[model samples]
Target: MSGPGPARPRLLGCDFSSTPSRRKPIVLAWGRCEGNTVMLEALERFPTLSAWTGRLAQVPAWIGGFDFPFGLPREFVIAQGWPLDWAGCMATYTALGRAELRERFVAFCAARPVGGKFAHRAADRPAGSSPSMKWVNPPVAWMMHAGVPGLLAAGAWLPGQGGVVGAPRVALEAYPGLVARDLLGARSYKSDERAKQTPQRQAARVELLHRLGAGEGRLGLRLQAPDALGQVFVDDASGDALDAALCLMLAAWGEARAESEGPGFGLPARMDPLEGWIVGA
Candidate 1:
């Protein structure tokens, strides 16, 4: 009698690259969530950050999970004497060149003791994510710099951190590794290096896909991908496509929560707006 209810909004998951190029583009998984199933529609590649930003702006409505830090640790911000508010802090942060940002972060770390060099967001421990300020070994600091500005400029709502009120397009910070580790548990499922793409890793990918399809995680959502698309997810040695797919699942999970939980998108109510919480953390 309800006649299937309203259609779900389009969902997206982004596997971002700080410096996107043709060889290592930003990978996006476009999909929709229906009941407990997250259906994959396509995988898009953006050869440059500008192209990616343009695509984000063009989409009329979407809930996107982006695999990048949207904010830095509050401790790091305070120690560096940066502004305490999200907008001011981000403005100061984005004004600096990558070289300068790295220099400041390095200096801040050098003042601290070994094993406690990097300051972490509260979300980091629960999400098992690297500190947002780390300049290398992933360079997520660069990711925040390159990625968050575009989200802000595109008028995508960032939940707790400031954004256009009631904006149709929503962006949430997401880390696919959290979902992967939940199912795989310390198993490495993907690698960018050719030599590291062993049969073992490939097997891990197969297992992850299977688990996701079966709705085996806390999110309680199954992944439905076309047979050919599923093969593409597994065959890409880099794991970019697969990671994007993981983010898509997280976005769907958040969207499901939004219907009941309001604008927090499943994030904690008391979360510090200065350091954004990862969705589902």
Candidate 2:
């Protein structure tokens, strides 16, 4: 019998925590695709940013979907008189201390009227993502402040940011809630609060997994999970595991598109470089 050929390239999706610790870690859901099927191979947990960044720097030849904004809204960037170019903006952004960043953002939000305090990126409209500058009630702004620079330092090529030539790793912005909503129709799946981890959400998780395995979504990609791995997804009350799986599927979808449609990982032609697009939205 012929020996197995080289292993298929893998794809990854990460559910990140801005403040990670032993109790709450950055979770990576990784897998490979075979035709229309995505096999969720493993879950990696990094309890600190250093550990996570090390993985990002060393890992090669994979497409990853991460749950953090790749860029802030162009309008917001412009208003702050920051660099118009993605690269410059990133450089300027990553240089600031978190306290200064937070103070600036808070002041910006406070000056605006109610119901219009936060500026939105173009991708936010379709993806239904929160404004990347919002510091409260999800605090995705901090996530971006903490996450994107690490990705760049790791030498991961961002599609909208002139894409590093010949770089093996491609990073795309992802939001698991977007995919979850597409499948389960606004049913809540995971919650950080112990009080909110209801049975309803648990059932929703199982149902979503079953639907994904059956290839019942926009990408038409099936999920393959053995019983042991499947239980791992269900048992996590915080939903980090489930979110990572959803992101992994999105990465697989983008990979399939890259093969058929010639790179860009299926992102739109007119996407804003200053405000990166979410992979599937």
Candidate 3:
């Protein structure tokens, strides 16, 4: 409709599978929001960790709102003596393989029995979720570990990189659901049930489109389907289909927030990823 308005830079949301094994590899979904409606698109199906990284080399240069953490838990870093900063820690993660990484994280959690299992971000106290090495939901921390390097290698910039105000460059470190929970109130719109994919789920999905600010004349935009690109939106009959749709809700919510809020959707200098935040709070 609007042919890519200035207010809305491309928003990308991904639901990564922590254990990207062949039996259940990582799932990557990308999407964008136009006003109240979100255009859902599926990126790739990585059956292996190596193939996943290998394919990430193809992500286009757009302001991405990835569902991965770009930072590490301050507590975990100090306790494990892992590199404390992004650049250094990435190098460390890159050096270690899956077996060693898991073993090390297990030991770290083992040391702290009660709450030791969860590491603390620098902003755990007042704000919340200062990007810790999380391994759940999407195991975003590892996603960051595996994903960010590719973005860097791709020569894209971070969220706050390059003093550009509204540049169409890459800005990683976005949690899409960071906004959806607020609008939907934990309403499970997505499920793995074929029967559950009844009118109810379809309706819920439609409703989400509106809350995301999508409409014919809302954001001055249109979702064009490029014939050359296929399978960008996976309609898996399993729970995976719903999961892919959930990623769209995330993208729409994120786009809405970025349109309203400043600097897109980012935590204050005091948020903690472990405790998590209230989405649009």
Candidate 4:
């Protein structure tokens, strides 16, 4: 309920999109420790950056993992003549409307050949994401635009990205799938379809929990259909919800680390407000 502690910081892992207008806003699943067990709360859906952030400010956490770029590739920001610093870069990007930003980003990619178009941050090279602000694959550039400024506005640590100094809110970039893959391999855990959230994925999740050392039994985490918001589906699967659920898992991990490791757990290496990082346990 308070700061990140051995009591388990509240975590929210997010799988963001370049645009959330048509999609299920921003999928959010929150996690915290219930006594000695790590469990998830009911999924909360937010319609915009404002709503998402308002919830975060109210919910005290050591840090939460957001699946978005921490910074834009220095090359891209430089090429575009945008601000060089994290805070400044966010200002420049967020000033533009979605249409304007998209057109400009697309133009940047159009000028370059197939593989030559987008810029890649140093972290993207290791993370295996394209540098360009393309909409598909990993639309990190767009994610940066939508996700970063919100955190900055909330006065969160952003880590590699300089945050509003002395803000109590702290957030680390995180990708739950990365950690899930480590624990569950390529096994698909959640589905967008009412039918696909089957025994198989449930079993997979149960097994995944065990791998995370939660062997006693089911805790607070359980995958269920979102009651209010329209569900998001990919290839006939409810991946959006699952992805949001995964974000919650990542938050739990970040909470654990920040409590044990201090502020270092929330800071980043390169400090990109545009290109985000993924925190691991």
- Model-by-model lDDT, in order? 0.93, 0.86, 0.51, 0.62
- Candidate 2 vs candidate 4: the TM-score winner is 2
What is the lDDT for 114 in model 1? 95
Writing each residue's lDDT as its tens digit, candidate 4 over 45-66 gives 6777788778777765545667
Q: In candidate 3, where is summed lDDT lowest over 10 consecutive residues?
A: 225-234
TM-score of candidate 3 on Cα atoms, chains taken together:
0.60
Tens digits of per-residue lDDT, candidate 3, 27-64, equal 66566665555565555567766675555445443445
Q: Which candidate is the best by TM-score?
A: 1
TM-score of each: 0.97, 0.95, 0.60, 0.71
**Model 2 residue 106 distance off true place after TM-score fit, in angstroms:** 2.2
Angstrom error at residue 46, model 1: 0.4
Ranking by TM-score: 1, 2, 4, 3
**Cα RMSD for predicted model 4:** 6.0
Off-target runs (Cα >4 Å) in candidate 2 are 1-8
The lowest-lDDT stretch of 10 consecutive residues in candidate 4 is: 227-236
RMSD of each candidate relative to the true structure: 1.9, 2.2, 6.8, 6.0
Best first by lDDT, ranked: 1, 2, 4, 3
lDDT of 2 by residue, 1-281 (tens): 99997555679999998889888999998888999999988999999998998998877678899998988888778878999999889889878887898888878888889999888988888888889888777889888888887787788888867457547788889989888888898799888999998999899999999999899978789999778879988888899988988889889988888889987888998898888899889
C-alpha root-mean-square deviation, candidate 1: 1.9
Q: Write the per-residue lDDT of candidate 1 for residues 37-147, one digit (tens) a residue.
A: 999999999999999999999988899999999899999999889999999999999999998988899899999999999999999999999999998988899999999
| Candidate 1 vs 3: which has more TM-score | 1
